[model samples]
Target chain A: MKNGRDPVIVGLADSALEGGRFVKQASVLGHCALVANEALKEAGLSMKDVDGLLTAGMWGVPGPGQLNTVTLGEYLGIMPMFVDGTNIGGSAFEAHVAHAAMALREGYCEVALIVYGSDQKSLRSRTLGGRPSVLNMQHETPYGMLTPVGGYAMAARRHMHEYGTKSEHLAEIAVAARKWAQLNPAATRQDDMSIDDVMDSMMISDPLHLLDCCLVTDGAGAIVMTTAERAKDLKTTPVSVKGYGESHSHWAISEMPDLAHLLPAAKAAKRAMEMAGVKHSDIDVTQIYDSFTITVLLSLEALGFCKPGEGGAFVSDGRIAPGGEFALNTSGGGLSALHPGMFGMFLLIEATRQLRGDCGARQVKGAETALVHGTGGTLSSGATVILQKGLQA
Target chain B: MSYDNPLPVIDQDSAPYWEAARQGRLDIPLCADCGKHHFYPRTVCPHCFSDKLSFDTVSGRGTVHSFTISRRPAGPGFADEVPYVVALIDLQEGPRMMSRIETDDVESVQIGSSVEVIFVRATDEVTFPYFKLT
Candidate 1:
């Protein structure tokens, strides 16, 4: 209610999710409704009490799932006063939290529900090479720049070129993520993983092994938000939306201002932490989007957790693994856990658990604050949200 | 994973760049207002928002800014071109662009290595710019 100045206006009450390794066919809308119901149930709230709908449209579609806001609202048959159909790719859900908080504070709605579900794996879908935009389809696509994996690989290669970052530095992240996935029952890659194992995997692009890329799986995640005042009346403890911000520098990777200076994520994190009155060192846990190892490395340095060109070194020696000084992607992340294309929502879900002292084996002990960062497109856009444990006055 | 290579969907903003490529030349937009260059040709300047832009042909020479020797085919269309090098080249004219380094020795492409542009005719009228080690 304080124009988002204070970090206590909105809190995530509950979330419901369904995902992973599906052999049967299902639509994006069905997953949306299922997660919405489960999320509301966790909050001990019903369809009648739901007043707002928030979601990033399904992934792999030509456009972000912008249509689902209406189809989902109609399918659920919930007449709501508020609906947000914003879509910015993987980080769209993170931006939704910012929108929901502003909406709840402005009295546009209470009990905002955000949902995401995708069947990319079940369908074995591969997004077409061409982007609808003239620049992508015509200006850029002809250069063999069709694959997102190739774009990210170029980034890693760039880092290596600039900072003397070795493939082993990136391999540490994959190995650490797999280590955490071993503890997460829901993670898809549960096999015992090692740096050698990652190194041995066939190269998808030069410098990135198959294991270095995020797993493709069908999954959904949903979370609920409400005014801080109403959170006191909810069944579960509230995780406050202390600070959040989103920004985009360019839609295509070729246009990024400078790879050395990571756009969007750097600016978004600066704004989020500035609003929260917290420093990078104050963060107890991090749930950064990991579409690839380079994404996480760039995000860490961009978010000011480490200095520029030091991300590859900062993540070395198992520093981000469980029981390390700095905790990152504690949910196994898109790397090993469920990644149905848009994996931003799950970052919040895991961050909330860490803040709530609920992550059993992977929990950061006494974690009171968690920073969630999401990267969309070929590192084109970014969103950062800081969450802290809520206590009544 | 299927047949034909993913081709460009040419439009107004892109026609000139494609046209110049077919002529075996590197013509990119240089903003007359900000006096800078940019890639993925745009209607106006990204820096100064200047509509006064011109497609100037420059010496097709640049240095490798960053590169990856992709051991796997980036697309099924490139299946025969496995272990190719894709690089972002910084032109002498102060703009960077992404293209493949067309060379037999993929291992020789390094950051700061000099490269010269070469045109590969993709179609009767369409050509794609590639980099050759200088």
Candidate 2:
């Protein structure tokens, strides 16, 4: 059995939403505080007990958002000794959890709180352009490639050229995500969808239809962590953070090590699983980030769930859909569920919920081990975390 | 004097490359140590991390590694150029770079298509090294 010093997630909460619509309007920071309070309440703790604060988002750039941890700490009245504002696109939260785990285990912080909130949907500020045409972005932005969709489209097209992966293979992923969304009440898009429907959606970028992309919604999620000994008195069942790892290869799509495969994800997943002493067969559920259908396909291959170039075949014939052998993105994922700008925080939240048996219709039966992975910044960054129920070895 | 498309911001590290482009030349950074070429001009060689680098004008020939057709305009600035082709070009000197494959018939462009660099003068100081099917 693991000792008491092992770091475990004691609380997890997200802002209540009905079909990705917040009941009440709030600023990005407002959403952050709302979710943080609820998560702390669930853990039977309060703002006074939070000694570490971590957050990341695409808000207030050119302003206070630059110092996100400091801005969030001031807003929440948290004088956290340990703060992390590391933002590597959407996968920032998964990396934050890895950082928090080390901070908790090393006695740098007693209680760690990681939060993420975004108002992109509410503010209607989401843009198709890439990051500001400055620095390294100057090379990509001048050419007018659609910010994210175009990059994924290039990858999807290349995957087809190399592995003979067809558009239908990618559409199956979107269709399956929508099928899972139909079971999730909070999912933004619950309507039934077919492969034909996905293929028919407007082509934002060639090879990537409208449905291939994730939804734009406003959301915030929080996770609270402490040592296993402190969890003995908490109200919620502590989910052990067995292992975690993160890596980024290149910011520019052209500089990616390989277009057909995700090298960083392969490295990150291998390290995390090895540290957890688990194998592919030991994983019961997963919450893979679905920024785009191709994202999921590439991620599955990188995670070693299937051989390279076999992700298309692996996800076909209702394999990852509802009642499929693999329960992937049980919260409907960023595809059908709420995307909220950054989707990694929700990946962590959903995996924790699945491990606690909190998911009702979409729950994996007797799920004990859940693997959550997040892909960020045009397939540039990858972070993986392996979680298990209680203190089981 | 009416070009409205976005232009690349030339910096200290990338100034020489842009200067060569203004002269209608495709100059890319070549590492003197490893004898390798790279794109988007960096101070150090990405392959061998060598500081001994010089800008060299090459044949400006490449193959289309991958591409995407932006059915919708990327932004308001690109509103007039709807349904354009953006592609990653595998340069003959061995380094991949992102560029637009300018063509009247978008359907004709495909992976492995042979392309050669063509310069488009956007402004007094900036010239985009666009690619066209050979």
Candidate 3:
């Protein structure tokens, strides 16, 4: 916390997933309000206290001319000082946190709320059937390579070819995650599974098993941020934003120059460490996105937590399991956890909980420092944030 | 077999890929100045950003860099084609292309297996490029 710029996350909340009420329970506008209200309640603040609102681009919904800040402010009867709608795939939430922090540091906003809620799992058939307008669908969707799984499959295929990575190794990641899910009450897939189970599961795309992909969930999450000076008086213990980094390698997987190396994550991780003045070993827990098991493996290598091409081996050896050298995705990750619209917020929530010692069975002991990484758009973009306790500015 | 539907559409950016498919050739964009080859058929050279590029028809010959036997069909259009192989073939000329394994069974598509390009006409405007075990 230096430079009078430390921003602290003071409040967080997520919606429940009961009654199969994914998308229909609340209109898209209502869903945003529902989660936003929960977050405000947790922070002991009224909507009038908010000065900024940030939201991810709605995945399957119509665009709101006014970004989330404007729309939410319009509903809450308060004008926001700043509004941001920077969309970067699942990592949108992480990117929003970084953007809000910068905005606060620049004295643009005294308080900011970053939120994401989606009804992807509950969308009508029409919304799910057509090509997304925001995507470069014209170029990549044809030839039956239209889905996210297809893009990640190509990446996994190349990784296997170049490094001799085994399918069993990928299965190891799914099996381990499922095992962790058994202890997570909120996990969607809590049944016992083994490597063979993953290998035997139906394949969605080549090299991408059904278990390898993330769950389609309907939920929303919000994070409240304020300057460190203001966060001291807040009800909750503030989780300080120690360091952050972000980079976009390409707009599409086909545009990525090297599948063997996830350069963006590497560069972003380096900058994050530099900004935090901490090393990789100092991190007690990590919540890297798991859109696919390969994502986690690749991120481990890119983040310098493990060597290149050793991701497969590193994960298979139980290095990321609970009580291992480093704990990863203790909330079961998107693979087994509920994946709201923007999965990145779930990573942030898990990281914050771990640093605050909120996770019950999956908590890493004495977890003082946490790393959260999010991958967006077919590994085309990535963002990393470091969080620590007692560092509030 | 069930009733057939119209083939998937191929846009301008990917049109050349389909054109090369019909000729039973695997063509990649090669930078004339840099002598570098790239995939996904971009008009400009990724390395030098030179628009001076040409479609170089290479020997469909390549080693299976990595491959996966998809047990489930990717889409309704491919439901009958379950347990198929999709592979990333590393061309000897330097480029990786995603194509299906043109084999009777999945077991035939193995890592490092030698493959040759083949074409299956999908419609008037779309033709899929596939690889067969050599």
Tell me the tens digit of each residue's lDDT in model 1 across B1-134.
23355567777887898899999889989998888987778898887899999899988899988776767654577778877887888899888888889988888878899999999877765788988998
Question: Relative to the true interface, what fraction of contacts does candidate 2 keep?
Answer: 0.84
Tens-place lDDT per residue, model 1, A196-259, is 8888999877777888899888877788888777766777777888889999886666677776
Relative to the unseen true structure, what is the C-alpha lDDT of residue A164 in candidate 1, on a scale of 0 to 100? 88
The candidate that wins on lDDT is 2
List the DockQ of the predictions in order.
0.56, 0.84, 0.27
TM-score of 3: 0.87
Local accuracy of candidate 3 as per-residue lDDT tens digits, B33-128: 999988767777778999988888888788876666655544566567666676667778877666667788777676779988778776655566
- Cα deviation at A391, candidate 1, in Å, is 3.7
Better structure of 1 and 3 per lDDT: 1
Error of 2 at A156 (Å): 0.7
Q: After superposition, how far is residue A345 of candidate 3 from its true place, in Å?
A: 0.6
Q: What is the interface RMSD of each candidate, in Å?
A: 2.6, 1.0, 4.7
Off by over 4 Å in 2: none
User: Model 1, A355: alpha-carbon shift in Å?
Assistant: 1.4
- Docking category of candidate 3: acceptable
Judged by whole-model lDDT over C-alpha atoms, candidate 1 comes out at 0.79
Worst 10 residues of 3 chain B by lDDT: B1-10
TM-score of each: 0.93, 0.99, 0.87
lDDT of each: 0.79, 0.91, 0.75
